[model samples]
Target: MAAADPPSPTGMGFFGMLSFRRSATAVASFDPAQEDELLALHALHAHVADRLEALSSHAQPQGPVLSLPFLSKLLDAVLSSSDAFRAVLALAPVAAAVSRPPADRLAADLLDRSIKMLDVLNAASLTLASLRGAHRAALTAASCLLAPALHRAHFARARRAIARIFPDDAKAGATAPSPSSRTMRALSVSVSKNWSAGRHMNAMAAHLAPPPQVPAAAAAGAGCGLGLALYTMSSVLVFAMWALVAAVPCQDRASAAISPPVAPPKQAQWAVPMSSLQDRIAEEWRRREKKGSSSGSAATAGLLAEMQAVERAARDLNSLLEEIAEEEEDEQAAVAIVSEERTREVTEQAEELAAACRALEDGLAPLERQVRAVFHRVVACRAEVVRCMEHVPRTASSNAAASASGVPPPQHHSF
Candidate 1:
């Protein structure tokens, strides 16, 4: 009997998305040429670009900004790209093709990037927790919106919990900063004012830092295709992380922009799609960035469709609270009329908040799972890449690589 095919290297969650084996081969043949490997890399990158474009285009109704749907696809793209990247890097040919120095450098770049991404995941988890806290508080407040007896009581109870999300610049250097006013805490990021996501993002950009120019295949000598592929992979990896930071709320979130993605060469097929998507997302970021909290638009609160909805709904509820309170003061009534219109207004606003809350509730758990999945994917790929370089000697041929490693040449599973 024939032996079973080896376990897929791209992880079981994603392998079903695309065949990772050499199709139509009667046996486990795994020979592919240098040009075929390069084409495999190109196809991988193009698939990523196509998915991102589709993600943005289809979600145009959600202010065409990054939404929950867009983020889901974006994270999927990262997973697919990382799979292709690590799969290619693990091949005996790739190990043979890239020299030790350049390979080490590439691995170092990716490893550093993976470390930064972990930090991003941590911040994202915290930010999501803050949002969940605010979400629950909003629901609680909604329950009390029309309850005259609970007006002051509910707001008093929720005010402190919800206030922890807004960022305050004055508190940036404070070892133990005092909370801001109720109005100031309406919507935004963490109460951890000293933590500047922008600063962290900038540091990451400075660390992985793009090269002045991507080397020509000829200039890269024997390992041209693999070397160039690694560089391009690193660039896309960095851009993906930067995009994640921008799409989610964090401390000083708007400052999370990284230098625009390094454009792929015009000759590359994915160049047009990739560049167009970058321009579109940047435009969205610019629109929200300019509106900002100072612009008095809740639109800048976040790029998530549900996040924006939740904040707008929260504002609507807050406005109703203000109006009712003012009405009570003017009429000088110890008990305000529980009139149909007033109750209706309160109910409508609370329902709006509930709708937004439901949207967030439905999407957030999956979103968290995806982020955690991405974190582990990057970790696995980084370890594989480092191991790839460590096992590959400086001057080994593909045969030597296969022989030394006691494995067959790996197949190129280009989608």
Candidate 2:
């Protein structure tokens, strides 16, 4: 036999082997029609949701899961719906602001939505791994298209998680002093006055500012070109300032100058300036001095008019009171005469209440029957469900074993 030439690395034979290996791998890993893959992803999602529920029921952590850094990674890996993530995270600050318990509705909703998002991610990841052919190509394209959306979703979820972890503080800080008071104090320091006086002057002084001082001649001479320009400019500035000062109304300057020296308005300044009002008050006071002055001519002249009217009213009131007393006595006598009637009314009402209670009790009878009937139906339904579900494990085991033995599964209903 002729000696076989050494296998050439550059030859078609080597290339053909490499291609075959690659094709085999592609075929093994790709599943374009991966129905089971999709199902598995869904199953995993459901499992995760159930897990989240279990976590919620148990004692809540000091912080919400939404705030967790892991959530950011997980969400980034899986989320595609940016709007959905934002909606959920938006509730986080609200949950924190209310200082609610972990079981609060907003927090629970966030947990539920997060669990759902995880489900979506699990489904997507599985779909990415198992997909093949055109389906794989489509999903890959879709994932690229949705990249921004996924990123935004991750950001929104992260924000919500932060809100849940840090609740708002109702008592944030001490109350600040009023703005007016602060303004007064600032003015007092500026013009060498007390706080009370400063308040009145500050508002008017806003317009009475003094001109800036001129720089010294030596300083001007020693200046660089810019400084010389500034120094030379000083005279022009003084003229401008004087012009501005002259433009201010005389009344404004007078008010501004005097305001700081003024004190707060006194109570008498608030009262109406009328001599008659003072004299009338004094005359009314003098009438109450003597023992007989309480009913004297001076007292009865003007101020005692109302008191005289009150005396007449007292006489009327006493007459009315006597009439009312007689009427009340008559009413009491009548009430005694009708005591039997009231008792009869009460007895009738009691009997009616007893009848109503008996009727209510009777009404519950049918409800009791319904409850029992429902209970039995539920039991039957549960048994049927258990029986149906029980077959699943055995069927799965059998299918697995048959697959291993090169046997086919039994044909069942097809969708």
Candidate 3:
């Protein structure tokens, strides 16, 4: 034996000690540029964490009511956090390139957390816009109350002007002239020299007319009989045509009456409960961290999975809102042309969209809660990591000093 080498500092075996030494050497040998980059990344993480905490504080409410002031503050916080988050995302690839495995995993987790926070912020923004729109609509409706009176005044003015143009006869005492009298008066005023000339020509022609070949009485009797026969034939034809029309069914009406009814669309369902998934992810992280495994990687994966689920729910909600918007546009365009029959259809569609919005909101509530809880947890974890990182260098320096002074290194708990 080569003078039984002094027991390794790690105390596991030669191999374990060698591994520890190698790791320490690698950390010590990190390029100055890489170290600077890592520090910058970590600082960015701290900034983002602070922003998140501020946002959460502003968003947190003890009661159901969300005041306008609170919402405004929350919006501001979210906007600031979003700006910091974007900066972090932009530097993520660079951070990944220079960071160790644990740090890399942490960066990824922070990215996921930031994305989820953004999703929550977006949903809140949409809700705020909707509330503002409804408020404006209520104000507009209130303003419309004055319209009817204005319209009445306008109509009265128009009626007065018309009465002046075509005044009613006071001497008539509400008894208007008959249609025959009016027509006769108009005809008398329209008569001219042409009418008198035509009447004189007709009298001259009748006086000089040739006599009929047959007796007048026989001719009259024959004419009457012919006219009676023609009348009877016309009456029979009219009755037959009416009966034919009544007996035949219309093809279009029959087809419409027998058309099949359309089936309603299926309602959407969420497969995973967001709250339960969040709990599972947090528990798994805790268990993995205790076991000394790569808990960061595991935790990041869980967060990603949860984030995807949340994104899906948010996407569905956005799609539903888009559909509602389209329906509203259609309703508005049709307002001028809408008939009594179509009004009911439009109303029914409005009700359906309202119901859909309510359902979407109900579904999003749980997801929002889950996101908030995860955000809080992630922020706490980040704080701990930052604290540990700050302590590590100080502890390492103290240990080196102790070793140089022939004193034992101070024992410390592993992170």
TM-scores, one per candidate = 0.73, 0.19, 0.25
Where is model 2 poorest over a 10-residue stretch in terms of lDDT? 220-229
Worst 10 residues of 3 by lDDT: 262-271
Q: How close is candidate 2 to the true structure, as a TM-score?
A: 0.19
lDDT, candidate 3, at 369: 45
Give the residue spans of candidate 1 off by over 4 A: 1-32, 61-64, 101-104, 146-196, 206-220, 296-301, 394-415
Provide the overall lDDT of each model, using Cα atoms, as 2-decimal numbers. 0.60, 0.27, 0.30
Off by over 4 Å in 3: 1-340, 364-371, 404-407, 410-415
Model 3 Cα displacement at 30 (Å)?
Answer: 32
Per lDDT, the best of the predicted structures is 1
lDDT of 2 by residue, 1-415 (tens): 9755434323222113223323432445363323222232233333333332333333124321221122222222122222222222222222122112211222223233333222222222221122112122222222332232223232223223222212231123322222233322210122222222222223322322211223322211111111111111121122211211121111122222221211211111111211222233233333333423544422111122222232233223223324534654786643322233433432343333334323333333342233233233323433432343345466668889999999997542100
- Give me candidate 3's TM-score against the actual structure: 0.25
lDDT of 3 by residue, 276-303 (tens): 2223333433443354344322111111
lDDT of 3 at 279: 34
Clashing pairs in 2: 31-132, 32-132, 66-161, 67-161
